[model samples]
Target chain A: MYNDIIIENFSDPQHVGDLESADIELEVGNSVCGDRIRVQILLDDNKISNALFRAWGCATSVATANIFCDSLLNQSLDSVCQRDVEYKQQMLGELSPSQHHCMDILNELHQLLSEQRVAEDVANG
Target chain B: MDRQQLAGYFDYNATTPVSPAVAEAMTATLGQFANASSNHAEAIRNRNAMQQARVSVAEMLGTSADKVFFTSGGSEANNWAIKGRLFNHLNKPGHIITTAIEHPSVLETVRYFEKQFGFKVSYLKPQSNGAISISDFMAALQEDTQLVSMMYANNETGVIQPISEVAKITSARGIKLHVDGVQLVGKRAIDVEACDIDYLSFSAHKFYGPKGVGGLYIKENNSLSPLIHGGGQELGLRSGTENLLAISGLAKAAEEAKCAIAQWDQHAQACKHLMVDLIQQADISVEFNGDTTYANALSNTLNMAIKGVRGEALAVLMDKKHGFIISIGSACSNNKQKTLSAVLLAMGLDEERIQSSIRVSFGQYTTTADIENFVTALNQCVKQLSAMSFAS
Candidate 1:
């Protein structure tokens, strides 16, 4: 049944080192099911310019985090603006509801960028 | 190398290959198939065959034919004994006592009774040796305590509990005793009458008979309501069409076991020697989980925890490279949750120890060559994993 995801990612995947260097940090997922991801969003001008993640779990979670980072690099800061739902849709496509169990990693990625935007707006005011 | 790979089976406590003698008897019985419950002359002959089978099982158990009732296997027999006894004693919905390391058939059945019937249960914790003290059981018994169930030998550790001693205590207090004897049935001699046991469960597969057939030894006149209510097959205690062919096979297996117990011990001893040799030669520190000496453990089964290597990784490597089939814990509990075994936790081992524990149990068919191959494979796996962990 799980043959599609039978790959065992024993080696440390890309961007799996430190969130200690990250400004805005988010940890998504749990250890019980053996997957946890830390998304580190480096923001510029209320948009996410760089997204790197450190994940320790099964193959699926590691690959998902790698995909998330691939989607976020060099994107405009306005991509994460709360009113910019169109841009959000453009960056991330539709997925299954249960996929949110894993997609929550992306959700936190978005949420952290939005939080950075809010903090930027407040600091400027 | 793949074709020449040395194969070994260490899960005999789980089941065994059907011996040639048992297969022959089952094949012969299959030719003269008749409905044992029917009233015809051929039916009478079939019924006689079943009775003789029952006598053989009874003789192996040191009990009488009237007390033995067959079921699908050990789990079903356990359900019947535990639930039936509890059902019959609904009025006395008091506490039941059992050990923590019992097979799930006993532990889960008791848990079911506790959940569905409001009955209390005292799961006696085992000492570091993986055997329950009689004093612990005696202390747990109370006025409303209706039953004390303990396994004759643990399925995971093969540590034998003192059922006879526990039976003596329960009988003295006019309480009932149920022994889950799935692992102990062919490994050792059991006498329900001699032990004063009220109920005992056994599975044929564990002793080289066909699967889906086992029997529960209920002392004559013991109060136990039928777990399955239907046409009175096992004296109205259990109801269903009897597996006459399998019963004949079980009887043959039991008879064969009675003659082979002595030979079986020598195999266990040889396996034990291999285990001791492996432990002694290992460079990394390892600890044998339970009391290897004090506990009435089967010499065939050994639970060991390596200091630094992960058991799951090692087991996987052994299977891929060496074709050695083994387990981290009981196959029944190998469900969705990958648990560090509750048996070890109850014995108060640390989490790392529990995580690294691997169970390597043997049967009559296990040979010294298989053990030596396994030891070689295990040493290689452990060394590889230890190096990998360090490099990481």
Candidate 2:
């Protein structure tokens, strides 16, 4: 049972393609349900510019990947990394009990993105 | 919205739409006020309903009416077949031989017997084509084996088993054979006596009948202990008052199925071939999951793994956007999503292929136009989902 937002995004996902010019390519999956989400982001001056995704799983998870990538466009990398994990969990909007696992996929995608930034910060220092 | 509003529907194995005749029969029986077990003159209507229903069910099963016992549905019929046979022999050491790809009702029942009653079980793994090899079953046969439980056709892949061969062996050796014929009934002809099946299970809903009414056929000499001890209904094999309304519905369905079986088989075969032809003509890359040859499988079911797309996502796009309804695996096994199908997994399918596999089963209601429209919708959905998947 998906909400309107899920049905809308799942029907026609905009950011569902590979970005060849990406600065960071991150992939996360839920081994339980076999949901895989790969995100490719292009960074400009430590800010997100272009974001695209490739996903395989339920409709909710596929839509979540698109929605997550949409939220990252033109935002400073530091701000997203600083965003609370709790806030990131609900950023995908309301999910039913069955669709709740997509939140974990989103969080994992965010965590992978943050881990990449943390590594860059350490290397620069 | 109902299925009539959907763009396409191919999930007949899940449950068929109740036929109009079955509904009318059930409606007519609702006023049978007396209990089926009661012997008063006022009870004759209900009692006659149950008796006539039993006759029809037995005729459908190719058995005498005396051997038919009514239960709630396939699961209960299966439970009664397994536990009814093994419940009394728990203390004794015995062996059970069943396929790894059986419905959960039979699979879990045998597993429980092995763990709770110390009975040894041999789970016969399916061949790569999702078929149980006769040699493997022969190896599992033993002197101490008590019962062999297997399905007549797989619920997911629809691969027909070698029931006659196994029946010959088991009957000669005095071993009881319980066939879960839930999917095979009405779709194919069954002869329990000729096939030497000791216990056979079937459900009404599987054959365009009402739900909650199923029957089991026990051989004349083979007796199973009662699962429910109450007023001795169902020849004292299963207890409690019969659902007279549902029984009348099942009888009407059974009578209709006797004449419609061959016709259904023919129509379903045409639809199945049309689906395959459209997929090939569209240049869709898919691996047929089960045996494609009609000799080894049912003509109605076609399980395929579409390359570069997940089955669940494809099903979702078809259901939501295109209003198509299909299924990935057995509809009853959706409670646990973490695991892939034990049926396909037992057939040595890779996890990725198993995850991408979707089952498209046809029925008497399916038409050539429905198949063409379904393939068109499926093609578009597959292309869209493929673009989003890494496999593309």
Candidate 3:
């Protein structure tokens, strides 16, 4: 069962689809459950200017992706990287044990974004 | 407004609201405080009520009263049948043949026997039409096979299996056959004598009766070891104190269903036709899951897949936004797992189809207006979810 907030977010996901000319794009999926999430981010002066996601999976994964992207907007990459699975779980209250993998998708996205940032810095240097 | 009051119920396969007749019967029997096993006068009255309930159930199944054994519910009855048959030959665990789409009661019980005990099981996968082939069943039969269990109708797809044909094969082979009739008992008439079913399991709640009450029909001369050991109730096959109140309700419900079978069938067929027609008119890219011909499926159930939109999300949107209630799959598997429906997958449906499929079922009380409203709401939900999923 999902909480009211999760349902609301899933039904009307705020930021969805790809952002063309974006700074970074990341795609991740769980083969076991077949949930896939693709996140595109735009950077402005080292801060996240925009973040959008496209998800094809269960309610939790889709809702969590939207909520994660919504939280990333206007925040610096350091703060986005600091936000862990627990933070997202708190945002969407009381996910069942079976649905906890939704947060795993967020973690995977963060790892991808961090790796992309490091690769960009090395290239620029 | 409360969602319970406004929502259109399309999940009859999960459970039914107790009919007023069944409620009144249960209320009247609730005051009977005596134990049914005692020899006192009050106990005699309680015993009489149990026997009457048994007779009503047997009548519905077209079997004799003595052949029926009451259990907690369909799950318990299924467990009793599978475990009891295996335990009958305690030292020798032979082979079991069943379908992959059976309810967890049968699937899990067989799994336990295979893992904990030494029973070998052959799970027959359904064809794309959602029916198991009789030839495949015949081929799976082995010399050491002792029992075969298959459902009369699937809970998710409502696809009816050819149990009568399998029955003839098992009977001729001298192997015991058990039918999980939980989904079929009230939707259609079952003549145990005609079908030659050795054991059958049924639950009352699926037919407007009270929950926690069901019965198992055992053919004459067949014996099963007791699953619950005590009190010697249910002819010692299932031992526990009788649930007099629920049994009375079950009997009343069974009687009502028997009397109204033809009318109910017609109403359900009409509702299904109307819903399908309305869905077609909306021009949604939809694929009806399972046997859409109604020749092999129940009249009341319709499973469909809307391209691109997620089934679970659509179910939530329909319930939360539109006051419509339907199911993404079997109620038993809804909240427990995140995987696509195993029933659809076993029918050779791809992942997208499985994820987008929703099951809708109706009952005697469902009206034409209810079907119209459900289709309208479904059309809107599909359009909205499709936009959100496919938008750039």
TM-score of chain B of each: 0.94, 0.96, 0.96
TM-score of chain A of each: 0.59, 0.92, 0.91
**Superposition error at B229 for model 1 (Å):** 2.0
Docking class of 3: acceptable
Best by DockQ: 2
Order the candidates by TM-score, highest first — what do you get?
2, 3, 1
lDDT of 2 by residue, B1-392 (tens): 25574337688888887888999998888888789788898588678878888899889889889999888899999999999999867778689899888888998888988887799999999999888999999988888999999899988898999999999999999998999999999998888999999999999999989889988888953478988899887766688988888889889999999989999988888888888999999999999988977778888999999887878788889888878888884211222366577888999998888888899887887778888888889889999998888877
- Candidate 2 DockQ, CA atoms: 0.53
lDDT of 1 by residue, A14-121 (tens): 444444466567667643433466677676664455666665433344545655665566666465444354553333344333233444455666676667667867
Which ranges of candidate 2 are over 4 A from the true structure? A31-34, A43-47, A94-101, A118-125, B1-7, B329-337
Task: Give per-residue CA lDDT, model 3, range A19-108, as digits (tens).
Answer: 878888888887766667788899999999999888776777788888878888899888877776677568777877777776677778
Could you report the DockQ of all the candidates, in the order they appear? Answer: 0.07, 0.53, 0.32
Q: What is the RMSD, in Å, between candidate 3 and the native fold over all Cα?
A: 2.9
- Candidate 3, TM-score vs. the true structure? 0.92
Better structure of 1 and 2 per lDDT: 2
lDDT of 2 by residue, A1-125 (tens): 67777888899998988776889999987766777889999999888998999987878888998888888998998888777867876677777777778877787887888899988889999
Compose the digit string of candidate 3's lDDT tens values, residues B55-158: 99989999889999988899999998988888876588889999999999999999999999888999999999899999899899999998999999999888
Window of ten residues with lowest summed lDDT in model 1 chain A: A1-10
